[model samples]
Structures are given as structure tokens and as C-alpha cells.
Target: MASSRWIRPEVFPLFAAVGVAVGICGMQLVRNICTNPEVRVTKENRSAGVLDNFKEGENYAEHRFRKYVRNRTPQIMPSVNGFFSDPDLPTN
Candidate 1:
């Protein structure tokens, strides 16, 4: 029983280290998913759908224009204006 108690104490740190490693890995995975281009595009698409649904007039041309403006604002403006920018910005 005394020997078992000593072993348990020794194993506690190992388990704690494993838990920390797993937590770090999970955080990294979440960060990667949040920053992924495909994930960002999907989120943008969903946001546009929500915005389109809320518009009062239901005009297709207006909805398209709004989506285009929203999508282009961060992407096209900086590139054309020569603002310092990351080259990996999503194109699609």
C-alpha cells in the first residue's frame, strides 16, 4: 500500500503534463480552423445569407450589390490602394 501511494504521486505529474499537452493541441486546432480560408468563406457566405434574409425590399440586385460590397471591402480596396498587406488573402 505504501509503495502504491508513492507510485500514484509519481504518476500525477505525468497525467497533468498530458492534460496540458492536449489542451494546447486543442487550442491550436481551434485557432487553425478559425483562420482557415475555407472556413472564413463559409462564414462569409452564411453572413450574407442572413443579411439577405433581413433586407426589407427583397431586391435581387440590391442583395447582390450588398454582398459584393461586403466581400470586396477588405480584399479589393487594400490591394488596389497599395496598402501594406498579406498576400495570402482569400481570392475566391
Candidate 2:
């Protein structure tokens, strides 16, 4: 009668910790999906479909870091973005 489990009992704590971390992340994701204004669509706006106004400026941020950096220069790589987008291309 070889009654030995393949998964070692010593690894239970690791599995437990991982499970807790995953559970917490899942809970926060679900909460955000359900309650966040930017995520949830209003009943009146449902009919608008693709044409609905996003009003991104009025949406709530998930963290203070985002709120603080909102109006600041948002370009990740301004040089790349402005490659051919320059305003002064006096005809050659």
C-alpha cells in the first residue's frame, strides 16, 4: 500500500501564498470591473454603442499616481511620435 501523495506537504505554504495573492488580484479586478465609472456603461448610453462619448477626462483614476500625472507631458517618446509630425517643413 504505497499511500504517498505526489505533491509534498512542505509546498502547501507556497501554494497557499500563491493562492492568496491570486485571490486578492482577482477580487480587485472584479471590483474595478463592476464599480469603476470608466469601465461600466450607463443604461442611457448603452444605445449609443460605438458613437457614445467616452469623456475620458472625467473618468476616475484607479490610483493617485495617475491622478497626479494626468495633465503633465504624457508623451512616452516624443521624438518618435514627432518623427514626421513637425509643423515647420518649409518646402525644399
Candidate 3:
């Protein structure tokens, strides 16, 4: 039973290497997201109009995303036509 509880020494190094690689990848993804200019611009544009006032160093992405969503129409459902044929619909 004692022998069965052990991991092979060679396998430990492989697991550690994978962990290190994943950590590095995560760090790079964070860096890219934080530093991208287009993303920052889009966010800024949506939050405030192109001519709106701004405070120094304020992030505008949230406002920009909100404005963009507000200006777009909601998607129409294709199944709306089926509602007319429903048996429960009144003919009047």
C-alpha cells in the first residue's frame, strides 16, 4: 500500500514544467489584454461620445461598450412567424 501511494520522480518534473508553461501563458494573455490600444479606444469611444469630456487616465471601454449596445437593434427571432400558426392563437 505504501508503494502505491507514490508518484514516480520523473513524472513530478513533467508536471512542474507544465505548470510553469501555463503560468507563463496566463501572464502573456494578461499583458496583451491590458496593453492593447484598439481595445482601449473602443471602450473609451463607447462610454463617451467622440467629442465628450474626459478626465485624465479614465478607462472608457465600459461606457463605449454600453453605448454601442444601446445603439444596435435587438436581433429578430426567425421563429416569430410560427406563432401565427399556433393552434392556441385566436382567429379573430
Candidate 4:
């Protein structure tokens, strides 16, 4: 003879309410994930618009890098031992 623990009748309504709440929340979560811009931008959605975005990003990065390089001043730091830049080398 085996005895199983049976759920109390009063707890059934609580379980039912929790289940309904969980179901509603789960459905909402699924809808959000499906509709999210990042999630929706999958490889399957590839098009000219995606390519244009990538090209624009590359152009912007390259433009910023070029502007930085053009505006920055170059300087060589001397080592503590002063061995990296040879003092023996004649300066123009």
C-alpha cells in the first residue's frame, strides 16, 4: 500500500491564480522578445537597409579615426634607462 500527499482543497484556488498569472506574464514576455528590435534583426531579415547601416557605421568610424590622427601631436617618451632612444644617434 502506497500513500501520496494530496493537495488541500483551499490551496487549489491559490495554485489556479498563480498559474493564470504566470501564463499571462509568460505570454507578455514572449510577445516582447519577439517584437524587440535587436531580436527581430536576425540574419534572415538581411536586406539593403542592413547593408547601408553597416556601411554607414564603418564610414563614421573611419572618419572619426582620421580626424583624431590629423589633430593629435606625436611625441616619443624617453625610457627610465634612456636606452630605447639611442643618445649616440645624431639629431637633425
The model with the greatest TM-score is 2
Q: Give residue 45's lDDT in candidate 2 (0 to 100).
A: 57
TM-score per model over all chains:
0.34, 0.40, 0.37, 0.36
Task: State the lDDT of candidate 1 residue by residue for 2-91, as single tens digits.
Answer: 878667877889989999999999976785566433333565565654342433334423545477677565654766555445566665
Residue 42 alpha-carbon offset, candidate 4, angstroms: 3.3
Residue by residue across 1-92, what tens digits does model 4's lDDT show? 22234476777899899999999999767855664333344557644243335664555446645877786555455443346557875545
Q: How close is each model in CA RMSD to the real structure?
A: 16.5, 12.8, 13.4, 19.4
Task: List model 2 lDDT by residue over 38-69, tens digit each.
Answer: 56457875665554434542454435667787
lDDT minimum window of 10 residues, candidate 2 = 53-62
lDDT of 1: 0.60
Task: State each model's CA lDDT, in order.
Answer: 0.60, 0.68, 0.60, 0.60
**Model 3 over residues 12-73: C-alpha lDDT tens digits?**
88889999999999976775566543334465555764443344224533445577778655
What is the Cα-based lDDT of residue 1 in candidate 2?
32
Question: What is the total number of backbone clashes in candidate 3?
Answer: 7
Q: Which segments of candidate 1 are over 4 A away from where they belong?
A: 1-7, 38-92
